[model samples]
Target: MKLSTKELTESLRELILKGEFTSGEHMREIALAERFQVSRTPIRVALAANAKDGLLKYSRNRGYSVRSFDKRDIIDAFEMRSMLEGVASRVAAEQGMRLDAEQQARRACDVNDSLLLQNCEIDEASIEIWREQNQLFHSAILNQSGNRFMHEMMRIVQQIPAVYPPIIAPYRLQDLRLYNAQHRKILDCIIKRQGMRAEALMREHITGAGDIFCEAKPN
Candidate 1:
C-alpha cells in the first residue's frame, strides 16, 4: 500500500509495460492515488516522472495519458534494443563469461528445451515460464558484459511494450523453437569467445522478434 517514490514510479511503469493501461488512456491523479493508497502529491510526482521517462504524454490542459506508439516507434525501439543487446553479447564474450553466468544461461536454455518438449502449443502458463527463462538467459549475458551504460540504456529501451522479453516470446511452437535454437547458438559463440559471431547472432535474434511484431501490426 505504501510505496516510496521510486517504487511508485516503477509500479506505474510496470502497469504501462504490461498494457494494463491502454495506449492513449488518460490517468487521473485522484483515481491513481486512491488505487495505490497513496497521497495525490506522490501520484503527481510519479506521473511526472513517468512522463519524463516517455511512458506517459503530458498535454497543456489534459494532464498525462499513456503514450501511443505507432508501428514505426516500436520498430525503432526494437532496432535500438538489438544494437545494445548485441554489444552486450559481444562484450560478454570478449570478457569471457563468468562461470556462474554461464551456468545460469545454460540452465535457462535447458529449462526452455524441456518446456518446449512438454508443450506442443504453449499455453498461457507455459508462456510465463518461457518468459522467465528467456529473461534469465538474456540478463545473464548482460550482467556479464559489465557495461553499466548499456544496462541503463537497455532498461529504457525495453520499457516499450513489444520490446520487453516477456512480450517478445512467441506462442507458436515453431517460432518459439526457432528463438530457443538461436539462443543456443548465441550462447555457444559467447562461450567460445567468438565476439563477432555472438554479436551478430544476438542482433539477429532480437531483430527477428521485431520483424514478427511489425508484420503482425494492423494495416
Candidate 2:
C-alpha cells in the first residue's frame, strides 16, 4: 500500500513528537524515503510541509534538521500564545453569540471533563486523550476569533516542543491528573462566557505548564 503525503507527514510528526528524532538531527530526503518505503517526492513534500509548520528548520546546504527548543523558547512561545488566545476568547465573548465553533469548543471541553470523571487511574492513554481534547478546545476558540493570522500563528506556536503531550514521555500519573484539572478550570471559565476570566485562566494555564516543564528540565 502506498502512503499518502498526509500519512507520511503525520507519521514523521509523531516520531518527532515522541522524540524519536533528537533536536538538531539532520534529516536526509533519500534516507527518509528508504525508511518509509516511499518515493522521494512524497518525502520531500512531507519535509517541506513540516518545515513550514515549524517542526523542522531548513538551511541552504544543510537540508532539514529538527528544530531544537530550549526553556526560553518555550516560555516565550507560551507568552505569545496566551495573549493571542486570550484575544480570541475576548472576541468570541464580545460577539455575544454562540456559534457552531463555540459549541465545538464546549464539546471538546466536555470530553476532557468526562475523562477526568473516570477517576480510576491515569496513564499514557489518558494523557493522550487529554492532549487531544485540550488542543481541540483551544483551537475552537482561536478559529472562532475569526482572525486568520492569529489562528495560523497559534498553529505554528503549538508545533513547538513541549506544547503537545505537555510533560516528558515518562510522566507521572499525579502530574497528569493535575494538568487535566487545570484544563477543566479553563474550560469552565469559557463555558460561563467569562471572557476576561477565561483569558486569564488560559494565560496562567499555558505559562504554568511552561514553568513546570522548565523546572523539570524535560529537554
Candidate 3:
C-alpha cells in the first residue's frame, strides 16, 4: 500500500512509542521500507519528521536511532508536561468556559470511566477505546485553553514517547483506573470553577504517570 509522509510518520511514531523500537535502536531505511511495505523515500521523510519532534536522534555516521532517555530525562520531560498541562487547565477554567466544551469533556470522561471501572480483565481492544477517550479528554482541555502557543508546544511534547505512558507501555487495569480517577478529579475542579485546584491537580496527575513510567521496564 502507498503511504504518504504524514501517514508514514504516524505509523512510525506508533511503532516507536509502543516499544517496538527500543531506545537507541537504529532504524535502517531499507528494513523499515520493507516492514511498512513502502519505499525508502517515505521512510526517510517519516524519520526526519520524528527527529524534528525530538523522538529520534540523528548522526552523520549512524543515520537515525531511537532517542534514549535516562531517569533524569524522563523526570525533566514530565516536569515540563506538568507545567504546561497545569497552565492549560487553569486557562480553560479561567477564560475558556463553554457549555459545549464541558459537555464534550464530560462525555469523554464518562466513556473512559465506564471502560476502566469494570472488574473484568482489560483487553487490547478495550484499552484502545479508552486511549482514544483519554486523548479526547486531554485535547478538550488544551483546546479550551485559548492559547495557541501553549497548545502547539504541548502537541510537540505529547509526541515524545516517554511523556505518553499509555502508548509507550501497556498499562495494567488497576493503573488505568487510577489514572482515570485523576482525570475525573481534574474535571471536577474545572466544573466547579476552581482554577488553582484544577491546575494543581493536573500537574500532580501527570507527574504521577511519570513515576509509573520510571518504574516500568525500560524500552
Candidate 4:
C-alpha cells in the first residue's frame, strides 16, 4: 500500500534502526520503494527527511546512504541528550508546569510504578512496554518546558542516531531497579519544584546509563 510521507518516514526509520540495512548501504529510492511496497515518491520524501535527521547521508550524485555511528558518536549523542533533557526538566520546574502536562507525566510515572510493582522481567515485550511508557514521561517534561527550541532539539537527538536508551536496546542493559529509582528521583525533584536538582538528576540518569550502553558497544 502507498504510505504518506510521515508514515513512510517512520516505517523506514524503524527499519533502519532494526538493522535492515548495513552501515553505508545506499538506500536507492527504487529499491526502498520495492522493499516497503510503496512508490518512489514517498520513498524520496522519507529519505530526504531521514537525511535531515542525520540517519542518512545525502549527496548531489550519490543519493542516500545510512550513516554509521561510532562510539564517540554515541557518547556525544547522550551528552547532548542529557543536557537537553536536563534543561527541559529545569525549565519545567522553574516556569511552573502546566496542569495537564503535570498530570500526564504523573500518569506515566504511575504506569511505571505499577509495572515495577508487578516485578516485571527484562524481556523483549517488557522492553517495548517500558519504552512507550518512558517516552510519555519524558515527552511530558519536554512539552512542559515551554520552550519550542528545546522541543525541536529533543526531536533531533532522538532522530539523529539510533538511541538505545536505558530500557531500550542498551549496549549493556542497566538494572531496571536502579534505572527506575533514578526515574523516581527525577520525578520527585520535579514535583517538589526543585529546578536545579531535577536538572542534575536528569543529567546524571542519562549519562550514567549511557556509560553502560557505550561500554558494551564494540569499538
TM-scores of the candidates are 0.91, 0.80, 0.86, 0.86
Per-residue lDDT over 1-219 for candidate 1, one digit per residue giving the tens place of the 0 to 100 score: 589999999898877876678778889999999889999998999999988888899998999998877778878888999999999999999999999999999999999999998898777788879888998999999999788988888887877744233364434688888888999999999999999999999999999878887776652
What lDDT score belongs to each candidate, Candidate 1 first? 0.86, 0.74, 0.81, 0.78
Where in model 3 is the C-alpha error above 4 Å?
161-171, 217-219
Worst 10 residues of 4 by lDDT: 163-172
Write model 4 residue lDDT over 106-154, tens digit each, in one string.
Answer: 7877776677667545666766666678788889888887688887787
lDDT of 3 by residue, 1-219 (tens): 688789999989878876678778899999999998998888999999989888899999999998877666767777888999998899888775678888888898889788767757877788678878888888888889778898778766666644334453546778888888898889888878899999999999998887777677364
Candidate 2 per-residue C-alpha lDDT over 14-129 given as tens digits, one digit per residue, 9 for 90 to 100: 77776677788999888899999999999989998889888899998999999888877877787888788777776766664356776776677677678867756766687778
> Regarding lDDT, does 1 or 4 come out ahead?
1
The clash count for each model shown is 0, 0, 0, 0
Task: Evaluate model 3: give its TM-score.
Answer: 0.86
State candidate 1's TM-score.
Answer: 0.91
For candidate 2, which ten residues in a row score worst on lDDT? 161-170
After superposing candidate 1, which stretches have Cα over 4 Å from the reference? 161-171
TM-score order, best first, reads 1, 3, 4, 2
